[model samples]
Target: MKGRAIAGIALILLGAYLFFMRDENISTGSVFAYFWPTLFVIPVGILLHWLYFGVFGRSAVGVLVPAGIVTTTGIVCQIATLTDGWSYLWPGFILAVAVGLFELYWFSGRNKALLIPINILAGASLIFFVAFSISNLLGKLALGQPFLAIVFILAGAFLLAARKSTP
Candidate 1:
């Protein structure tokens, strides 16, 4: 427990540093700057959570919880980026969520079937998120108006809620 706590704190501090200190040449301004650091912290958090469960809890759920948190965080950050016109870090965020869902399914014991629908939704969400991000980045498509972001958020929320409601 102590180790997990320490790692969590370290990850948070690292995220803070990245958010506050990283330099970007993208010219998107402060909003993009603010999000760049999260690109680093989200992955570190997932790794630390994996280590924590592998060493301490010895339970798959332990890893899943932290990984899920990391995924959710990425979703949140990407939403902010899209809505606020912040530099689109959507690719990183999508990758984080993908990894998180993979870890969740991979670590889940025999109840894997229970996560199927949730995984499907998460997968779809990832696809849309990535597509939207890519389109926006390439300047080939406009950012999804208000409704689209809400849809993604709500879908992510439903997946999370469903996971929580399950065993």
Candidate 2:
């Protein structure tokens, strides 16, 4: 995680990309040309938040939530840009918020202050997923909808099992 180590890894990745460009049909350079800002913005934001949290001993959910949001948004943007599916990526924002809220809820020792946002964001992500599916943004079988359904089912089952076993 040191600066020199990260720089070395980045250089190695770049070297690999350059070496693979001849065989690949896509242009990695072009992609980087367009998304360079995102490459820096996302990691730097997350790193800052993580450093801040580390200083606090990772006990602060507030920092963790924002960090997760920043990281997720960056990754979603990169994927959408690469795939040329900007419109289809709209749901990712909702998902990022939901993830951040969930992280806050789960890591903040289940603080009551984080509950409202967690529920709200999670609901919003579901709404967006359904909307995307009905609109066929990514096709009839939008991946998020099924994944969300499975997640919901699994979570519900787990909660039920936990409750039944609790006495």
Best by lDDT: 2
lDDT (CA) per prediction: 0.60, 0.69
The root-mean-square deviation over C-alpha atoms between each candidate and the true structure, in angstroms, is 14.9, 9.8
Candidate 2 is scored at a TM of: 0.57
- Pairs clashing in candidate 2? none
- 134-158 in candidate 2: lDDT tens per residue? 6565354566567668889999998
lDDT (C-alpha) at residue 1 in model 1: 100
Runs of candidate 2 exceeding 4 Å displacement? 1-29, 58-60, 137-167
For model 1, what is the error of residue 1's alpha carbon versus the real structure, in angstroms, after optimal superposition? 25
Task: Assess the local accuracy of residue 83 in candidate 2 as a C-alpha lDDT between 0 and 100.
Answer: 52
lDDT of 1 by residue, 14-40 (tens): 565456456733345654455553556
**Pairs of residues at least 3 apart in sequence or in different chains that clash in candidate 1:** none
